[model samples]
Target: KFEQANGGTILLDEISEMDQGLQAKLLRVLQEQQVERVGGRKIINLDVRILATTNRKLEEYVAENKFREDLYYRLNVFPLQWLPLRERIADIVPLAQRLLAKYSRKMNRTAVSMSDEAQRVLQAHPWPGNVRELDNIIQRSLILQQGALIGPGDLHIQPGSMHTAEMAGRINSVGVSQADNSQLGNDMKQHEFQLIVDTLRETGGSRKDAADKLGISPRTLRYKLAKMREAGIDLDAELKG
Candidate 1:
């Protein structure tokens, strides 16, 4: 990959997960800006700009001796902290708009757009999975959308997942009360809650199978199940033995 990105850039995502052996090799490569192929006598030079990203705090990893300290400093040059998609509510709609156009062209759909209500829904979602999750939602919604405009009903997000920005947005735009907001939040979650329960039953209470069917991570499914448990929904009584 470094040889291929000779004059451009290479992104090493999830850098914190790299093993110690690989970290040593990467440190050497960064210092030398060169590489050699396995069981070969040829030395290849590189001019690639290295970019790395991690969802973890590297300093903590380094302090714990999980990551190399020298490599951490080497790669920390010009570092940028990316706020989560839920925090960057301002970027949500614009990013969605661009993604919509891109997907529309790829899918051979003509000039699809988002409705005002749909935009509001997009803004409201907590985006637990971040932009990748947002990408999934938009792509799925495009298929569900029947017309040029993507409406709130077309969106796949659980209705009850609320963000602070969403609450502010609602108050400013619709003059909705806190009480009304609570009701909307509660009602929206029922659909998602039921779907999960039904899927669990069909999978014979196998969460992994249900997660695979639902297109969510097992961890996410576990979290959802925890929420249901908190809501006093007794799933144990209903699941197949």
Candidate 2:
């Protein structure tokens, strides 16, 4: 195709999927304005502009010799790194609005707008899949709703870290591995136990409001308090009434 289309642009979607050998061949084409197609010796003179996208770090691959250094250099000529959606919360509302308009027409529904609380939750979310995930979520929300206003319940994104990579120990010291999860659960229990003890002191050992504030059932809180007592948590002395 290089011979047929001598002066054109090629979009290499997910270019990182190319092997090192193929990357080296691509580098040659980029440098010399020529191409030798697979299983063909005849070199074709071409003036093709290359546009590529990769989510992976090409330089890291080049350093590991997994990607050709020369190819990486050629592609890095006018590199543009897009910030992930999590970093650009400001774009969330506008992007969601756009998607709403687009899918509404496609699905033969009235255009929808997100509720203020919905927008707040959407903006607060860490969108790891970037625009693609947002698109899916909007589509799902639109289809699920009969009304024109989208609520926070419509956008079912969980209210925390959005990816396995994001959940792993980088910002939070709590790693997301199985062992780390066990430790995290234990730590959370300890923290909760301490908070309950303190709250009990403030309420003069009243369990009702403390259970309400903590968003747990009274029975559940009592069960936890009993467990804490068994573990030798000096609830009364810690409170020091």
Tens digit per residue, CA lDDT, model 2, 1-241: 5566568777887888998677777777778887777798987888877788998998888788888877777787799888998899888899989989987776567756889999998888877677877776776566435588999876666655343222111212322122232332444344345456655665677789765544457997888778666666666666673
* lDDT by residue (tens digit), candidate 1, 51-168: 8999999999999999999999999999999999989999999999998888777556787999888898888887876787677667666543537888876665675552222211
Error of 2 at 194 (Å): 47
Candidate 2: minimum summed lDDT over ten consecutive residues — where? Answer: 167-176
lDDT of each: 0.72, 0.68
Where is model 2 more than 4 Å wrong at Cα?
A: 1-9, 35-45, 161-241
Candidate 2 TM-score versus the reference: 0.55
The positional error of residue 119 in candidate 1, measured at the CA in angstroms, is 0.8
Off by over 4 Å in 1: 159-241
In model 1, which range of ten residues has the least summed lDDT? 167-176
Model 1 lDDT vs. the true structure? 0.72
